[model samples]
Target chain A: MSPGSVGTVATQHLDLPGSLPLDCGRSLRRVRVAYETYGTLSPARDNVILVCHALSGDAHAAGLSPDPPPEGTRDGFAAAASPKGIGWWDGMIGPGKAFDTDRFFVVSTNLLGGCRGTTGPSSTDPDTGRPYGSAFPVITVADMVRCERAFLAELRIDRLAAVAGGSLGGMQALEWATSYPDQVNNIVVIASTHALQPQGVAWNAIARESIMRDPAWQGGDYYGTGRAPDAGMGVARMVGHITYLSAPSLAEKFGRRLQSGGDLRYTLHEPEFEVESYLRHQASSFVRRFDANTYLHLSRALTYFQLDLPAAAETIMARTLLIAFSSDWLYPPSASEEIFDALRKSGKEAEFHLIDAPYGHDCFLLEEARQTPIVRDFLTEGRA
Target chain B: MSPGSVGTVATQHLDLPGSLPLDCGRSLRRVRVAYETYGTLSPARDNVILVCHALSGDAHAAGLSPDPPPEGTRDGFAAAASPKGIGWWDGMIGPGKAFDTDRFFVVSTNLLGGCRGTTGPSSTDPDTGRPYGSAFPVITVADMVRCERAFLAELRIDRLAAVAGGSLGGMQALEWATSYPDQVNNIVVIASTHALQPQGVAWNAIARESIMRDPAWQGGDYYGTGRAPDAGMGVARMVGHITYLSAPSLAEKFGRRLQSGGDLRYTLHEPEFEVESYLRHQASSFVRRFDANTYLHLSRALTYFQLDLPAAAETIMARTLLIAFSSDWLYPPSASEEIFDALRKSGKEAEFHLIDAPYGHDCFLLEEARQTPIVRDFLTEGRA
Candidate 1:
């Protein structure tokens, strides 16, 4: 029930005719892209903006979903309060929100290595007649952009008014701009970087280790097995849940308040602190909806993302809108500043808007109101 | 060798004559403590400076340990470069170093609920003649201080010239000052806090969850099971290790360097990034040395530490020295500032020094040279 939420929508999938080449030097024979669209394509198809999803996100970026996927799509804290059945970015893509579906068509897609109806590790390999699981080729952000481009080509959309997303999705948008500079008119990257900082790399590494170490993971071939690496994935989610939030935000949400009413329960196995309990809840919920191998693939790909934005400076015709959150230690404002500085140095038209927000990297998804004017004005003014 | 090294020390054990009371409303019988001493006791016994160790450290503080613990004592990433046979803080506690063993008899002990030859979850329970394991009562920082007080009492020492430590050890130091306010004359709390911040709480919680979720942990009673929760504990260590260092330090140390030259190995099962490889090595080494049950107990104990320093203002006679590193996001200078503000507001003697270092929480162990002068000046100035 957001002010301008796009009405109920369903994800649709399309298969690429040719094999999609991956950075791993392996090509996927049957590549499928699951997508959802808000707004309408103009007669010339010049108003279409390609939207990408983050590490755990999917095609349903805005509007209400007709059906909840087997695993819930709601991740992050405050998820319980987020309008149920609504898209992840429901607040930012509608008649009058940030993306402004009224004037421009916004299309979101599940990334190349996603599990949500996207041909990923969980998908059956046509050659082996088994889930790809361990057989899925390692993909890169560039490869994801390639898949998105091919998916759009099937729709007969050769050029885009813009490409946009946050976190991993933002990486995809950057890939689109850098790889197909002449095709994308503008790029909106939020709470992302040209490269993940080292600590961020370490966090992702630990998360992947957690999943792989689980005996249930069974060498990434656990799909046929009834059991999943839920415990390990839960721990991974907990780590990610904390990273997506700033310390101050956690402090405000759950301080050292004990789960028990007053005194310490004096139990080692049970959750004591309110934060501990919250983390457990977050972890459990995350493990249920996400695929472990898909997580490993996506995490590895994002970790490997190192954009040479400067090298593509000459060919890039896109007017870039780079938005970063001040409290996003995972993707700090310094990275956005680096991007902006590089773009300006190359004499490219760009606007960098750093939102002074406290929610950490989650700010990109949560701070919809603040981002509206900036994104709207940027896109509209670029046209003007 | 460290300058003025208190060379070739051995950990010694002593059993308390009576049962020690615990915060869990239970008492531990036949409680034993392992300790190492540097310098010599004065005729008046007033020259004793009790130095506590951090979460993973033991009684070995300023010298070359004559006998290496079975699993080895080195835990940091720079363990290879760190001098062999030396204590974790060998550089910081010698005759002319921070503790200045030349003037003061420095006493170091394996903390209560520690795995290092102390009466902890890994130790034998007098009643069952078996390892306490999950049966061990949860202990707190105050309980650790109480045990320290009892251990010192057994040695016929009624008061301490100073009590000092970093991280978890610093928590115990603050606990000592507040619990036995009249017994401790001065306290040096470095890169530690009165209470763990919410984010820190989350990290520790995730770590504990990592261990508990491992099937081999067997509800924390896996001591004799032949199968240890090495995988889970390794993941826990990886998480803890990353948190202990700054992002920039990792960037400087590892960057985006690949383990195999410059190409992606295109494998998910193996470590590709140098940081990932380093983490695996660190985790395996840590899992081999550390006890998972003891980790659970100690992690739980530290999480429960929420010292209300201002509440004990009237009884506190100790002059406090608070040292915080600039890059220590884990502990942070803001926490030290809070402690300083509380003491200052209570009209207590306190000095707050913020060192501009980049090692993060590990600064307490790595930036020994920078800390020595501040600690020595603080201790000596108090004596003067």
Candidate 2:
């Protein structure tokens, strides 16, 4: 293993002891969570920072995975996929990294509605002994947080030094603080929002529509049908990829450069621009690795992540550290400012930092070195 | 009928006398154009203003269509669809409007590769007596302008007082100014760019992918299959709808408002936000009237609109007027500034007006009143 890295790790699974209640009022039995841990758990189990994964993320948040999936978790131009087995957030979680595995035990779990080794729409229904498919109940960020809490209970880790994440993962961090206020000491919400802006909501809606519209989706029952909504899900991934990036970044990287030499090829069904080819690559890569039904559910969950934080603001125990990037239109810094304002209004400890960055929402993952000092300072304050 | 209104107009068709050559080194024969004309032709034959339409637009640019199609040729929330038969740009092309039909003979035509009563992909291929479909030649903005020039020749109209349009339409205007500089007096290009930026290219690519991925598209040969790529086209339209409007406009209009009740319903398939429903409505309504292949071709032409302006700068005669909106990200004001800079560099007469509006690229259509005086002044100078 590389210096300061958590080395190669294996994912572990746990079945919750009871039914996992969903926001849709349905209870999902046989709920299982896939997780990975870095560093040793202290005797008191207090030096814990539960790391949450965002949309299209898995439990492998840091270090090297002994066995990487055939499709590999990383999307092109998003992370440090130096080698295929490197974790999605390997830059930020290590012995001397932002999470500082030397001082804290870090736990990362796939969200409830995820397709990555978790009980999701792809999982079997206890009653029918078939994939839940369309029968899977809708979930919300709170339910995801609830599943994380239940998973932690099995590990005998009742409280956490921090609950942290970015994008949807950040939403989960915010949910963790509010849902289990007494259990978490600090919450780091990066490049996320209390509720998506209307335009953001519209993009997510378009993505879900793209997936569900595919005839091969078969109303979310394509499992074992020898067909999948890869086409539709490919479109969904393309849309998401564009939204996660800033205009300037695209300009700097691809600009108006053609994929081929000089002359224009007047074809309707082919990619012409470098950016067009990049998006197609991303779409094809994503459709192979991700499940369409899970995309629909998780995208819906993130859009439904409107927090009733004011209601739970009073008894919240966690101190909030909100970090947002200027170019993150998906989850603008204004949302973080709103959170900080509300927390201050409730006399809760909070800090909101707007990083003037150009990487857009992906900055939370790509701008790791710049974020490390700020995150380490915040974590140190918590220890004080 | 109504004050300052043209009252009513009918679209007329004309067949080109010969084969029209394309930029791709191919030729389209037996080409037809659908057009509408208002006001009188001057004795001197210099009072003609050739108006062009953007993607999804047609020859019916003003007045009322006596016989509207079943789909009504209207997308909800786009234009003044107050009375159904109203032309898409009726507000800006009437008796005392910006185009001032009382003074100038305003001519509007469905573009070359259009589905609206013009020769396009849906047009019959003489070789097989079947719709062009996959056999349709790929077209560019220059090709559309070439077709327009041919269509005008059939009318014995040699010179244009001005050529004007917005977005993709604006690209056509720029093409005419350079391609036939000696034949045109002035040009009005609104919310357009000499070359589409990489981000814009990415969005267009995504929309195209959405349509092509639909099974019903059948590789653009779904004409007689009793089905269309409506599902994919719907998703494409949804994407276009969002991109055409600004985020602040969407936030102000919808503002995280729920679709049904005050609380969340927790449904995966159904839309939760008002913006989501609005997009669906826009998508569904669009697919009903617009041809998917036409959309694909037009979108491609617009993306491939990168101009070698510097090469064509010398020996160009038209005075240029470019207008852009502050919030128009799809065709941002920066593009207008670029055009102005390029024109000035070439010692050409050019004027650029950046209107500080919040409607985004749709501003060129919606901000008719604000654009009137500016357009009027520019036209008045041409006649002076």
Candidate 3:
């Protein structure tokens, strides 16, 4: 394995004896969850910060161990490098950023429906010894949060200093605060909402449909087969990539400029404009590290997210800070306002800020001077 | 034989003989254009108002003859009923509306590469007698305008009282002034721009990809194959429909409401929210009337549109009105400013108005009260 790559972590399975009734007509039995952790736990075990990844993200959040595993032996759990890997969150995390690694013990785990060393559709069914694929039970954001809590208990972490994330990660952060209020002290929800809007669900449904419609999908059981649903997955990624950007950002990066040819071929098959090529690149990169079934699962989970439970808000233990962007269409500024209103109505300690950024929904991932002070002040307040 | 369908118009074919050199290195030839017309041509042939339609709209601008054609007739050019039929443009193009049908002899024609009465990818290729499908040559907005000019000449109309349209129709109106400066008198371009922005192209590309990736697409030759690419086309429409509405509209229409059931299903395959169902409805309606190949062709044409021909601006017909909406994201207010600036710089008669409407990009199609006065004043000015 490459340096800084986290090899396949050991899977510890647990069978929760009772059955939990789901919103769907089905019930889950003997629920088993798999997870991973990073950094050393403090004596008090109260400095934990749970990092939840987005739909395609995994448990590998930060640095790798010094002893590396053999190459190809850590395919699933190995933390894949981003185009600018650790640098993707350089301004927000590290030794000196808001999520300072030197002070807090960060624990980033693979989501329940994820394929990165987690019990997802790609996992082998213990009974049939084949990939679960279509047979795997569908999951929700609440279920994923439950799995994270289970992983923390297994690691002996009793409480969390804060739970924070953006996009789907932000959704998980909100869930953490509501489902297990006593376990979290502070909550930072960035570029997210209480639930998915129709536009958001509509986009997700199309992406899911694209993957399932691919012939190579083989009803989601394509594992062990030489061919994968690359085409469908690529199309789905293209859709997601579009949502991740603000309109202004796309125009700045790839205007009506033609590709290297300097001229457009009036043919439907060929990509005439530079924007088409740019989207194709984003799609191809995603297919390399993601599983089709996992994408479908996670997208659905996001669509079903809801924090309207009276009980969840009534038992809140953490003070919340909601951050939103002006140009984010996917999770617009209005979404942040709704969450802030909910917290206020519940008589909870909550603060909201709408950051002026033209980078759209993904502004949280970009570097802006305005965000630094806001985040710094929030994280450093009343710290022991 | 549907009573109100726009497919009943008799089509007149014109073989365009001009070989215009394009910026795209490729030269187009043997351009066969199919079109339709409405209203009687005055003896002077000067009282003409050109009507343009949106992306999926056809030339059957208005009116349906009470006399029906005999059954089993294979004639494809009879004027068909509009989707909205008589009520669609009730506020704009009735007897005494802004487009006063009694005074002006209105003309509307199906665009080139359109599946309606016009020659498009679905039309039998003269060279092969087979549907062009994926093999159809890509077209540009300028090419579409070129075909429109031919349709106008065949009707013996030398000049138009005003050229008006919304969205893609608005694009054609602007192109008319730039491509054939002297032929147009008054130009009313609403909720449109000189070129497709990066965000617009990105959305269009995703929509096209969704259709192409569908297995039923059959490389664009799904016609007569029983299985159409409805899933992919529906997904494409859903993406477009989102861009047409404002964030405020979406929140108000489908907040966090659950679909019929109050419970949240933990499954990935089911839609636990009401918003997903709403999008599905929108997507399904679009697929029923649109052809996948035509959608792909027209979307690409919209992306390639650019009417800022500096040299042509000096010679453009005077008297132009540019209208934009504050909430329109697809064609933001800034785009309208660009057009207004160009016309003013060229010392032409031009006026720009930014209407404050919360309907997003579809404001022009929805707000008739605001659009009526603006259009009426522009067209009535300096009229005979």
Positional deviation of residue B382's Cα in model 3 after best superposition, in angstroms: 3.3
Each candidate's TM vs. the true structure?
A: 0.98, 0.98, 0.87
Residue runs of model 3 more than 4 Å from their true location after superposition: A1-38, A64-91, A225-227, A309-313, A344-347, A368-373, B1-36, B64-91, B224-227, B265-271, B309-312
Q: What lDDT, from 0 to 1, does candidate 1 have?
A: 0.88
Candidate 1 lDDT over residue span B1-384, tens digit each: 446899899999999889999988998998899999999899999999999988888888868877776555666654767666688888778888888888899999999999888899989999999999888888998889899999999999999999999999898889898888888899999999989999999999999999999999999889888998999999999999999999899999999888998788878888989999999988988888889988888888888898776675555679999999999999989999988988888899999999998889998888888898999999888961
lDDT of 2 by residue, B49-139 (tens): 9999989889998888888765654454554445677777887998889999889999999999999988999999888999999899999
- Candidate numbers, best TM-score first, in rank order: 2, 1, 3
Residues A1-384 of candidate 2: C-alpha lDDT, one tens digit per residue? 789899998888889988988787888899989999999899888899999998988999988888887666667666334678788888899999999999999999988988988899999999999999999888899999999999998999999999999999999988888778888999999999988888999999999999999999999999999999999999999999999989999999888888786777888877888899999889888888899999999999898887765765676679999999999988999989988888988999998889999989889988888899989999998751
Q: What digit string (tens of lDDT, one per residue) describes model 3 on residues A93-143?
A: 555457666677766767786876777788777658888888877778887
DockQ of each: 0.89, 0.92, 0.57
Scored against the true structure, residue B321 in model 1 reaches a CA lDDT of: 96
What's the residue-level lDDT of A54 in candidate 2? 89
Per-model C-alpha lDDT, please?
Answer: 0.88, 0.89, 0.72
DockQ for model 1 equals 0.89
Kindly give the stretch of ten consecutive residues in candidate 3 chain B with the minimal lDDT sum: B70-79
Candidate 2 TM-score versus the reference: 0.98
Model 1 compared with the native: what TM-score? Answer: 0.98
